[model samples]
Target: MAERKLLAGHAIRRLRRQLGLSQVAMAEALDMSPSYLNLIERNQRPVSAAVLLRLAEAYDFDPRKLNAAAPGGGADAVRRRLSDPLFADLAIDRHQLEEWLAGAPDGAEAFARAYDRMGGGAAPGAAPDAEAAVRREIERWRNHFPDLDAVAEALADELRMGAGDLYGAMAERLRVKHQLSVRILPAEVMPGLTRRLDLHARQLQLSEMLDPSSRSFALAEQLAQEARGEIDALVRGAALDRLGERMYRRHLTGYFAAALTMPYARFLRACEASGYDVALLERRFGASWEQIAHRLTTLHRVGARGLPFFLLRVDRAGQVSKRLAGASAAPLAEGAGTCPLWNVYEAFARPDELLTQLVALEDGSRWFTMTRCVRRHGMRVGGVAARFAVTLGLTTGAAGPLAAAAGVALEGAAVPIGLGCRACTRPDCPQRSAAPTGRTRVMPERETGASPFGFAAD
Candidate 1:
């Protein structure tokens, strides 16, 4: 296969204008001739790897950001909106869509947002579920908020503390700056409440049932809530409705909490050095497995980035509770059941054990996935606990470095899986529970086949 050409002239032009640099000056910064830079900006020349590295060094840019394909994020959003069953009969041209997205990325984004608000239907008042819409918005950005990361970096600098001392520093800041008293109340008194703030008394109450890591995260979230201006700036013009705004704010608080706990620069270096070992990261940062997994998805800094990985949390019933994808690995349908063949659900049988698998999707794309069951509540024996399985998935291409570092072989046969039985087209899958959409089922009259559903081959 031929390598895809990177014609990111528009991105280059935008960056040049943002930096207030003339063509000659930018060319000099990149150590390229003015004419060559002009050709590149006019989409007459494809950006070379050497030029990409030079741009990274000069402007501290992520090479991925400058790729023409990367600008189709808005296009991906549009595609996702159109994938809804409401538009199942619509025949859309892919090339034309890409042309429109490349020509007017902002217009594509606005249209996608409008479609989302309209619930992909003709009626303007047909709004989607607020929480689900918020989730889609978060997924649209790949769950990486540079603004939140920047805010966390600033706070980390202001404190000048290590991860071990983060909790104490945050607590001190809360008391000294916010004049709020922090108290841990017994679970009996604060039933069903993890953290609560009493504004009248300026008291922050935390449940004693929470572990040390949870307590620290609660403090970080409280600090994040105090930064209302930053949060508002991040969510401004997101086209979120009232409920969507509330849910987005909640998600933003969680993002800030993770950022504060694992400061971007330090955590990213540690992540790369440690080969993204979740156990080691959890021990080093004083975070839970879930926290570490969620934090791994946010390593999308411009210049210095860690491996692009996606995180998914699922219950024993095969329901996906949360999902965050770093790239277009696979479409995680909201509120839909996942493949039982996925190790996320299998992890429940072997609780607390790290289970790794290389799975091939219906699209023939392979991914390396690691799953482990996590207890959400207290670890004390004889106490009722809430448990969920978390899976971290990475594309085969992105898994190379980590696979080498972790001594995992990627040459072996990969397990076959699908989005779900409803959308999966794999005819030989014995684990399928339902017939795939738009496929006719052929009931056997004489004998039963090895598979459950016998469908006519396409």
Candidate 2:
């Protein structure tokens, strides 16, 4: 630790300000001259181990966190962001990034954020917005927050309800402990809102339109308000913008609600016993297939992990609505429109049934997928059922738990699929909607080919 320089100028400044102590006050407390502290805070001088210890002692922080920072993860992430094709035009080097991070942390962050969303939208690399960043984070973490999982599990123990009665238990807990009564109001009375907390009235009002599962979910979200300490800790660690923070917080709240309903320990047991049967699990837990698919992705607790599943939701227009990734793999779709070959889109045709497919990507990875159409929990869209198709997929071999139910599916031929039409290069795909970039379209005057467009490479 003493051998290497620890340039924590921005962190030190933040810590000092967080403590509400001025530079001179902090320097005096740390037994250092104000000028020297200023130099350290400005990154003109490296903070030594002794100074780090003194700062920790004076500010009640862990010195080891600073010592362990190494090159600072921010610089590394910025370098990776620069490497993306979106930033190919920007010629930012490592040294420049380090200096920017050290000298003007706030300005550097704003610049990086601006650079990330250069042209806006999810067209190729233009999507560095809070939603996309949170999506990437969900994929990176495999949609599982262990600390939140533990908290949900402890709460589940407190609720201690049987399979179908978790809702009543939660409501009762809210009523008895929090002095909050749960009231189901008509849609006309609640208007478009599904759930609202009236603190003055001590009531948690719910629209009568919400399904039982969604009502339980709403209560769980309210219950999650009390888990803000852990949630804030996790959110702060992410370092998101205002919108990004709110998005992540909402996602985490939903996660807590799901975990509270299923509870990791029991959910895993039910999953194993049922061999990943979505319907059986839905019946057992009184959750929708959508909710069951979501819970399946979160069984990544250490020493008791379930199969790492990938999940995605797509509407009839082939627009992606929800995306969840496996512990070992990235999620399926990057943008709204995805490959037409996947059964997630096909499931919409048979809305009530579970559809399974074995698909092989261009990369030679075969995934066994189970897809089903699901209605949105509590709301109608365009005066119709807000329906979406959800899919759960994992590597072919790892899907052994689903062998019996998905046996015929596993035995089926692997349909070729790609990331999406915009990013895919499968020239021979009959379902190809648009020409892949860098491919010259070839035409035959006298004959029509299997695909709408043929590439010169073909």
Candidate 3:
């Protein structure tokens, strides 16, 4: 159906965007021209079987995704439909369609086509690209010590307070100092009101309709921008980049704001007494699911006493947000830890479900993940109306009592996890969607099998 094709096209386009590739850039990589790439994107040119294989080989894209979603029909019918003589009435040619099919990559052409179908997409509002800013800041910080990451595991156990407490303290400071009004506006009001901070009016409005947890996080994020300068300054040095300087300031201020609400000593005590129950911690700090997740990862600063934990956040469709850790067994710095089998994706379609998994990394680390929905209560609004879930996971060695508190029964021993499929070296994994890098086919038909990739003698 047209609808199914559109959905598939949209997914392909999304992948292209996430990888930060432009149509021209992708065409160049795939050894094709940009104009022909454009036609394929419009779905006017069906992706050739060969290009699909190449995409899987290069990027680890699930090859099944391209062929499985389209309606059942041969490539020839698709070509005829595109080249229908009705187009000779329009002077369009079949050779143009064939050329696009033969030369372009799957995602490049699809992205162009989707754009044309959408009638030209527009940039979202300018509320600041927080993710980019955060990465820049974090990377700058990492560059400074080149060694701050060295003591994560040991320091995680030294910092006695749950990371949540520090974040909480920062949130409180914002509320009292700014007198920023925090309200739960209805879904319709979410657009203009969710993150409106009118400094002149001395008012901060948030959509109340958001789950109580998300409401608190939005407030905390705003407050953090102002409150934690002193804390962040303590770590200041010649290492911070311009953007990192700005974001670190915001992060520290947020920490101060959270500290204002939930002081370190006090929050630390609560975690000890409550046994680090995240749900209980959620109630204790008035924070959202993700806020609590972030707090868990930050438990490594000075004097904290807890096992090292690494945290990763992935959305429904597999876009990753935060990757933080004070742990050795984590690979948070390079790429998102994604597994197609991860139950986190289910949380989007089934909002009420809480899925847990013990994932293995290719390097042999085991991660304990908890996935649930974290939605901004809205259908149509200026702010994003899309509700997504977040998965908070740490290694099994550092999981502590929280797993028991949540009643999560551990599964079989951890499975191997990779930073991302491309950089992974796990051979013979059934879940692999693409060929591992450096793979080359020695035997042609012998390589034919359910698995898209064939064996290559390393």
Best candidate according to lDDT? 1
Backbone clashes in each candidate structure, one number apiece? 0, 0, 37
Give TM-scores for every candidate, taking all chains together and pairing residue i with residue i. 0.79, 0.73, 0.55
* Local distance difference test, each candidate: 0.75, 0.74, 0.51
Q: Which lDDT tens digits does candidate 2 get at residues 214-270?
A: 888899988886688989986886667888899999999999999888989999998
RMSD for each model, in Å, please? 6.0, 7.7, 19.4
Off by over 4 Å in 3: 1-190, 208-211, 214-242, 378-384, 405-412, 441-443, 447-450
1-458, model 1: which lDDT tens digit per residue?
02557777777878899899999999999998999998887667888888888989999987655532233244555665554434544546678777766666556656665665564444666647676567666765677878788888788777764334877888888999999878988877886788899999898898888898999999999999666786896577356778889889988999999998899998988887877878888999999999998898878765677887888888777766787766543554331447878777778789968998888876567888888999886434666677899888887767876633266667668888876776677888888777765668888889787677877764
lDDT at 129, model 3? 43
Name every residue pair that clashes in candidate 2.
none
Candidates 1 and 3, the one with greater lDDT: 1
Off by over 4 Å in 1: 1-73, 78-97, 103-111, 114-127, 161-164, 332-336, 378-384, 403-405
Per-residue CA lDDT of candidate 3, range 1-458, in tens? 22233223333455578799998887776667887666666565556656666667767887544433232112332332332212223434457544444444353345433332332222444333444434333332321111222222222223324354533433444556666554445656655445676776666666555565555555545644442343454346323446546666655544443443444445557776776666787787777666666555544333554445555666666776555533323453334246676666778778776677777765455677777887755335455656666766666755656644255544456656665554454566677666544445443754555455554645
Give the top-scoring candidate (TM-score). Answer: 1
Q: Residue 193's C-alpha lDDT in candidate 1? A: 81
